[model samples]
Target chain A: MAFPPEHEIHRRRFGRNIGVAVTLALFIVLVFALTVVKVTRGDPMQAFDHSVRPELAAEEAE
Target chain B: MSDIRAYEQPGEAGFGDYVQLLKPRVMSLVVFTALVGLLVAPVSVHPVIAFASILFIALGAGASGALNMWWDADIDAVMRRTKSRPVPAGKVAAGEALAVGLALSGIAVVMLGLAANWLAAGLLAFTIFFYAVVYSMWLKRSTPQNIVIGGAAGAFPPMIGWACATGGISVESLLMFALIFMWTPPHFWALALFMKDDYSNAGVPMLTVTHGRKATRTHILVYTILLVPVAVGAAFTSIGGPIYLAASIALNGWFLIGAWRIWRRDEAMAEADGYATEKSVFRFSLSYLFLHFGAFLAEAALRPYGMGGW
Candidate 1:
């Protein structure tokens, strides 16, 4: 059966949106997992320090 | 009653239209990179603040997407892949998209600064400008290297996330940025190889159209090769671990193979085969980046067990 023009357009639009939404949901899950790992396991502040201030690591060591 | 009849019928805006405004596809990449940055950094933001920071970053990404849609409505009208965007499809006015983009851009930068640090906020602001002005307005139509240079704007989210955590930039975050920067060319070139007609119709000078498909394919393979060292190198950094190294090796190997497959296919064969190699490369590129970033999270998980980063 042929769908109405407006209905077909809406359907196509909805399908595209669902595709984008699923991609986004997957991304959120990935991000959350990363945040949990960092927050729970490592000192995020220290990680930041080492990340941003590498020279500082040497100075501190000295 | 007579005056009411004079008013034009307003088109209704659907939920899907709003989602289009958020540019969910682009937001996904931004969110992933930002999360990695937040996770790999040495600083720890409060959980609530972290969430808020990411939300703002996503909003900023959406704002950039909206502005891009607004400015490119002319070209987007012709391209098959983008012709159905809200503005081009007539679902949303260009003016409205512009307003939403500007408003969200301001809100995201200010809120990110309030939630995290000014450095992160500043980076978000610069990213928006780079995307909206440098890539969308200037480079897109002017050169074939649009994706090459424009990719930098897309690569900044992770660095901003890192900044939010550490309140500054670092070597590790730069390395993460470099990985995405290098990966963007091959990832986009693969799509261009198959979608050559779209760029041609849109009057956009994509590499495939400007330089030919064979050249684009060669460039894709070269970039894919370059991406390998950057991805593998990250595994040796403070954020790297056994899990990340193993995952990077396996994923990058498969990715190189996919690139090789794309490079090996002749135009006639690719057309006869329905561009299967091109399509596979495009699909794999998406998963490849996700898996690489996901590996970082896995490494982070193993850290407590002393199995991560040398």
Candidate 2:
């Protein structure tokens, strides 16, 4: 059909759907970027990795 | 025949309603405090990770906010300040808020773990639980001391942000947490003091409702006094320096004077003057917090040039 949705509610629903779609797409990008960062990071990044980092030490010493 | 349903209910919810269900105003503070926490830490985080972590942290805060709106819809409908909120105003269904809250809570916690660390994730999870279950569900309606304890839920984001950077909590993080924590009572009590009709009509046991207005004024004074130390003491930490110390002293001094003025006023005087002092203090408290955090940001920014921190 070549016509727009008949009602204002339908138009609103269309907009909401677009919002959800864009949000989902952004989330996917975020996940992918986080994966790349985690994989490419040379040193262990988390505190649980048992590696001693000075910044983490600042938590105690500061 | 195009037989698909256009909408589900008698009332329609725009995307904005769903966004409103997340309490965007509260989320802004969460994002700001969390950002300050992440940046002020002694360690550095990758920009992508930092951005993702802050986003998820804000989402976690928004999720908890949605849960609060869901549970408090009844009182929200009664209180004038909240009567126009999405769930209460019939723009969004309570069940939708519940679903969104629960789903976002899970997603945010898990995503933060992947993007940052398990400790930060765990802290985020606890903050959500604290806000949604402990504070919103349990403390808010039941106790006069609700704001005192419930404030911790709002206070956790900075510490969580710090954890995202350093992978753990620190005195600096704790002080940031404490600054908001102590600030909440007086800030809210000042609001409650002025919006006197809202809580009592809704049967919410706000300090003004349970304990008398005079007592709440006293409480405001006491908490503001206690808050000054925590805000000023942060200056001695790794994240703090001369700038933060100066900002805290001035802010705390003004805040104390406001609280003192609030304490000295009887309801008759307040009513005659339209609670002007209470209202001004309430407005000032927002700036008070923003400036304190801004000072922290300034210190962190200037640190590389041999000027910022102690």
Candidate 3:
């Protein structure tokens, strides 16, 4: 049996490509949402202090 | 150019092959130990950040696995156990594995630094380097004590996870490191005892291949004996509690018994039972690690209610 044409194969796989893109986009969105929640709901200063700033930055900010 | 062009075909690396390159089994262990490290720390981390940090740590582990596969493709090709691996089996190209490893290593380290602390990121980087370069490229092919030294690479994940939360190292994390580092030799040597032919065929100098099964068995008992103090001692640390202490005692007791049994067995008896005791010990070692780490998590879970720790 003969396979589909090369372009036909490519056209058929476009759906999968779209699926991959959508999945990737959703993951990015989820990460961004989590970051936003963490920064806003959690202690933004404490997070920033521990991860980014110098020692005792949270106390200094307080 | 035409002749060279004819030699290459588009590689058929499926998603599974990519995952195989990551060595998901090893990554799962890394993730578990790292999670324990993060959770058991005294410092509180934002839940989202904790999750992100573990994700990056797992990725760093995967990167190490991929690079190891890329570098060990030659040796892997000859070993029955690893001959069918993605790189050795011709499912994935060495260059592609290297690229993926390098890319993920960079992403995991930098993103972890942003999400957690530089110390954790630095530890993760060193883990990848130690596993990929120091262990796979150098020690693996050099000596019988390869696993003994290379075990440090595996031992660092929990320390990295602890660093993610605490932003520094502590005695507790060092004890966890010691637990894995000391446990690695006997655990692997037990398998080496069973799979001696694989190492012999591959020309890899496992303790079993280099020093013989008798010496390997003795070494297993010695390490297991040494491991007893480290495991029991962790019970007194900040991460340890009543639950952890109980788990450690039970686990180490069984582990010691298993090691002792393996030590006493002659090659004839092992061959008669098809190395049943060695196999059992090998399998038990896995649960030994899991339960020990699980105890850490249990203690962490109990701490908010004030039931954990001394």
Candidate 4:
């Protein structure tokens, strides 16, 4: 089941290229996705409105 | 002269080999789910601390990967899917992987504790132990239902991340954990169907190997069916919103169709068709989990407008 030398070389080259392309594409997609989420989601503080101190106070006062 | 082998082996290991040891692909999933957990939590952490916590979580995930590689090098050598790993390929020594894994595990847990809370650190420690000791050493070779139970290791990051932010676990975090837990069997089983020979050759007791392929297929369908309700249920949780509901409905429908198709497949037809059905289901399983979690993010985004949860 030995691959031909030339075929092996070609396969190795193809694998290397695919790995690089996939890694780069993943990086680009991650950056794009995070940026979109950040822009659309707004700030976390604004979403919750309550802080650690207030929550603690309310719990203790209860 | 023979003892001076350092002179002959002048170069240190390459970066790619180190990356391979970390199982970067698996770490990506860990990072995504943990990010979702952090984002959807009720408490707010500073941006820098949030980033640091995620980074440490990712590092901890990588450490588990390295340890798994170290421990499974023998079996990995026999399995085509894993034969090219750094340890199996001899690019990285098993001892080096163990050292790296232990070092990273300590750093990630301690740093996460400092940046976040002790609860997150404790969860991270337990996760590393679950993956390295319980899953890898005990269950993987010993049982057919390995992935079903072992999947808990992979399901912990989000809960840990949630704890990092809120300093406690909540039902929301547990729901997130459940989503991944229920999703793991069907997902891994699909791959097992396609790679049955790999497990058989390596003498690993994957479901497809211990049970017949038909039974495995039925299990996949059943798990997929069960997964839909869990996913849809999460949409009604406090962290879930309209966007998540819509996404869950659409994705779960497609996944169910795929799983049903897989269940209907006969072994002869699958073999005749080069297992196209299994391969497609396997690929879809990957996207299914990712998209479901991504929708959770979408739900979080819509939370400010009162468009999410009831």
Candidate 5:
């Protein structure tokens, strides 16, 4: 079978590239949002303390 | 110019070529080390934040790789080993690589700063700069000790990872850095021993090219000897434990034996056997890094059960 016309091929390639770039950009934005929530509200290091060394968590709690 | 033009066939660049520009092999190592660093740290991060932080750090690594490819395209075009890389092969344009690198660098840094702390983000930024600007542009062509000094760029991942979790550097993180740093010279020189011709043809001042195979052999053994203590010493750190100590001992023993074999072989013997010893050492070096880092991951996993660390 023959391929599509040159312009059609170009359009397809352009569309694919743009789609990937947009997906990646959106993912980065989501990560940024999650990160802000983690920093401001979540106990990022609390899990670490309780999980790695329970004594530290008890100390902090006391 | 003509050499670069040789690879410039009349075809449109593909997305895979753009991915190739990121040097996924190098990026994978960066990601793995950073993950180990984060996991083995004393503080725990939320799983989501951990995932995002690793992703951003990986992007930073890929960004540096793209920039290095853009800058090193000229040498890469001439080197047999690197001739098929996206930029050097003309599958991707240098300007395009620069744009991708800069864009990713900014995104990864800003997002990491938001997700983690400024210290981790700042270290990531410095790592990118050191690899792209300091190593690729300045050290690579200028010194035979390029891999020695440039090794610092690759050695920063675990430190950066630990910093992401704890927001500070510690003895544990520095030990991780030291393990990678001391491992670099021997690891790379083993490859150079087999691929000296590529460096010579590319006009890069590799130790094997400048110092000759004899001195390169000696240097490999010397660095390997120096690396042993650092590798063993890390087992005593907060991030280390019995499993890591056992793994480190076995791996270092194997590595030293390989280095000894490499040191004892002459040029004629190496060529006669097709550089078998050198090639084996080079292949082994890859596993060496993976296993050491894997041990750290194991220790981290064991810690939750109270079986890891001192």
Candidate 6:
């Protein structure tokens, strides 16, 4: 079947749709990067945050 | 012909309309403060995670903005300053805002947990709730103290950033939070002084509307007096250094002079000058906050060189 001609509503809203699409794509990339970083860094607490709570026994200090 | 007629409707919203619904200007403040909070922390966060956490924090802040617009659509439509907002201006529906707020809120909170930790996530959730429900729904229309309490919601971002890095709060985060909290009243009251009818017309119970212009001026002076110590005192914290101290003392002195000038003016004098003093002070309040946060960022940036902190 042939595609119907574009309507004004669709034309006006085209940018909105694309913006939302871009936002969702970025969200996905961010989440994937977060996952990779979390895995590679092991325990986030041990990797950072030692100075803030120095009283706690050092698990793995740099 | 009927379908064509239907399709010809004007005032249809663009993507920017939805962005306006999120209150991008306010979100920029949230993003900046949160980034400073993260960067200034003694704990180091991975770049990727820091970016994601700040992103979600900003999303959470935007969610609160959407919810505020949703709840305030009536008042927004009435206020000249807010009449052009997407919902009140008929570019978007209230239900759509509510939906966007809820969806983004849930996603942001949960994702913050995954990216950072539960502490940061919980703080984000609380900040959203404080702004959306506590301030927007409850306090905004009820009391003149609305902005004072509502300011806490805005103040939470830095603490959340600190939490994101350290998984806990500290004196430094608390001081940052306090700085914004104390500054909110005077900053907004100055705007209210010049905005005149925007709050009164909307029945928002802003200090100017509830007490009186004279009383509002006094309140501005009082809050500015209170804000000086917080702003200057932060210079003595771990995140503070010579740059922050110099900036804070100068900025706070200028801010104090602005407040005192506003306090000394009467309505007749203000009217004769068209609230010029109020408007200038309001403008300065923006820079006051940006520079204070910038000082925090500077101190953190200079720390590696042994120049940032004492």
Best by DockQ: 6
lDDT of 1 at B49: 71
Ranking by DockQ: 6, 2, 5, 3, 1, 4
Clashing residue pairs in candidate 3 are none
Docking class of 3: incorrect
As a TM-score, model 2 comes out at 0.92
In lDDT terms, how accurate is model 5?
A: 0.90
Reference-based TM-score, model 6: 0.92
Model 4, span B74-125: residue lDDT tens: 9999999999898888778999999989989998898788667899999999
Stretches of candidate 3 above 4 Å error? Answer: A1-23, A34-62, B1-11
List the pairs of residues colliding in candidate 5: A48-B44
- For model 1, the stretches where C-alpha displacement exceeds 4 angstroms are A1-62, B1-10
Docking class of 1: incorrect
> 3 or 5: which has the higher DockQ?
5
Structure candidate 4, residue pairs in collision? none
Model 6 chain B: lowest-lDDT 10 consecutive positions: B1-10
Per candidate, native contacts kept equal: 0.00, 0.74, 0.04, 0.00, 0.22, 0.78
Residue by residue across B89-108, what tens digits does model 3's lDDT show? 88789999999899999988
Candidate 4 segments whose C-alpha is farther than 4 A from its true place: A1-62, B1-4, B7-12
Residue-pair clash count for candidate 1: 11
- What tens digits encode model 1's per-residue C-alpha lDDT throughout B1-310? 6434323324435557866977898898899889988987777667767887898899999999999999999999998898888898888899989998998899889878866789999999999999999999999999999999999998999999999999888888998999999999999999988886999898889999999998988999999999999999999998888888998999999999999988888899999988998999899989988988888877776777887667
Q: Name the candidate that leads on lDDT.
A: 2
Higher-ranked by DockQ: 1 or 6: 6
Q: Positional deviation of A8 in candidate 2, in angstroms?
A: 0.6
Over the true interface residues, superposed, what is the Cα RMSD of model 1? 7.2
